[model samples]
Target: MNCKLLSVLCVAASVHAASAFTIDYDIPAGNVIVDSIEGDVAKVRQDLRDTKNGWFYWAFRVKGAAGKTVKFVFTDKYGGGPVGVRGPVVSKDGGKTFAYPLDGKSKADGFTYTFGPDEDETLFYECHPYVLANWEAFVARHAADIAAGKMKVETLCKSRKGADVPRVRYGCLSGTPKYRFLVTCRHHCSESMASWVVEGIADAFMADDDLGKWLRENVELMCVPMMDFDGVQAGDQGKNRAPHDHNRDYTEFLYPETKALTEWVMGYAGGRLDAFLDVHCPWVRGQYNEFVYTPLKDPKVYPATEGFFSATIEKLQEGGLRYKASDDLGFGVSWNKGVTYEQGWSSSSWVVHNVKGLKTCRSFEIPFANANGAVVTPEKCRLFGHGVANALRVLMENSQPKL
Candidate 1:
């Protein structure tokens, strides 16, 4: 079928299968693909479109089970960062409205499931649900809130070629003794979903809830929204590229963004910074694939910072994000030891090894393609980010005595 005709059918089919099921892999067609759409539930799939901001959209559907519970699971192949997997939601009024529910779940196995959607209903999510235009508009609408000193924006540092690394710092108050946390996103460039999680964390901070207030009082955050600007804007993989990879450049300080951040950490930190975090998508395949990374097993000879890293992970776990000392490959093991993988580098490892006074440092990997067997989506990402922020807070509070 032609692209237009196929697109129409894909949408129709997605609407037909909203009870329980999932779509697998990147459709790569910029349109939806129905794997199975019949009966009380159907499964659909779609490829992440190569857009300006580089995002993927998953499609959904539901029918005949009005008010009945339903769930879905989604998976992707070319997951980059948290934004790699889109989300799913339902619409009862015939595909005209949507709402997010805490009813879905994700696994470290590359599967995503939303358990309940009444029959004869429609669903929507980040997967084929929204695009760059929507996000840009959202950012635009919140520009004033960000500019009015309520949220501060600054240049973290300049890239190797002198490009400026812009960062957004959000909190309710100023001049408070916050914990001083740093979160960098899109380090690999193509991981666009990292942007969404960054946005979600910022929004949560701005909401000024108790946790947010506590965050404002105990934490000062800095976020480099898009680290690999050139690559992201250019739509290149940005991982394992020639000359230097953004993550690898941390050691040599070659790339402008990496160099800028390295410099910023040295200058902005008053030797009392609490935590440092790097966010990205997992690209590895198999069981230990869809999980977060905390430096557990430090390699034999590489810059062994496992002592500090272990303490930090402990604090992070106290905050709600589950973690373990698995044989997960970390920055030191991959880059410092010359263990070359597709994407091998870590800001967490870089900071723990090089930067002084950064007590709790770690990188979190949210699966985009198949995190624990479920597709990563905006909603899942939001939850994951909250867990991240919470863990950062805990790490901060826990590290106070040492600092």
Candidate 2:
């Protein structure tokens, strides 16, 4: 072979090897559209799917990029871009665990990552993702309790896609309890951080501590961890979906999940729900999305809601994520007005209007990445959940009649 031909072939091989990296969204809860890849830079944007307007939720996996630094640049043409305050929540271990790479590698539109020598693959998400695997791990952790019947895991309903939606009944599972609390998460499928909070709440209620014992005796907690199971699993942005998302379907009971959840709650409560807490994650970044807050619902229930917010703030101060009473969005303040629900009523609103003897019905929004300058980690979110559990105990205690 001629020397010139050999040199040309060698150069072509190097170029091909350098550009062999692949990006895909085939995993569970994955969403992304790869635009193009040039050298080490990949142009990408979130896959909006059935989302009405623009929503910021995306996840994808990078493979064959080992030992190479790749820069993921997201486009903002399709609504708000997918980048958050602290950049991407990344999992080096193939989605087993994720943490925000706040190590100065992020820009306003995207982030850069350098894969390790042996790192065959890595997962990146808008926020830490919580899918069925995460939930199954939690269930496994409390296997003994579940086996003993202290915690009952039952199917909430079959999703439209034929998946079994799980509902966990913790605390006071036997007979009737003095109080019944309904806690739900993931009304918006992409709000994965809230699932960590739900796990934290369940942990607190099932612990052997004084609070857990008291809860097991006096309160019956029903938790529907994933409300939009199909959307969550399929990685759909469940907020403002076409006709309406699961949250907005509360009034008309459009989605099968919403219908089943409402009917189940109504029948299970038997006329009264002491507390209805729906956990969610606010917008990707900015203002109210950067902190933990509850949207005040209904004027007649404001006083009680105010007291509960105060209690939660007090408990949060003791430990966990930082929350202040001033952060609570009032009923008419900002986007808390009725026009926001023009499509339909939200879960909290529906419960407030329909459920009888409800002490407090509110939605708690946990930020996706940042909360009051603190990085929102799974463990920290769980700690926040503990604070919420303590606050709920206070609310229940306040509701009981004095002897």
Best by TM-score: 2
lDDT of 1 by residue, 190-265 (tens): 5655666666666656655776778766667777777876555444456655655687776666677877776677
Question: How does candidate 1 score on lDDT?
Answer: 0.53
- Which pairs of residues collide in candidate 2? none
Supply the TM-score for candidate 1: 0.58
C-alpha RMSD between model 1 and the true structure: 9.4
Candidate 1 local Cα displacement, residue 308, angstroms = 11
Show the lowest summed lDDT stretch of 10 residues, model 1.
22-31
**Candidate topping lDDT:** 2
Instruction: Give per-residue CA lDDT, model 2, range 1-403, as digits (tens).
Output: 9999999999998988876898999887999999998889999988889998898898899999889988888976453466888888888987777777653567758888889998888888888888998899899999999877669899989899989999989989998998888999999999998998888888887899998998889888888999999988889889989888999998788778888888887887775788788999999878899998888865764336555555565555433567877788878889998899998988887877778766677788999878888878888888888778888888766664211
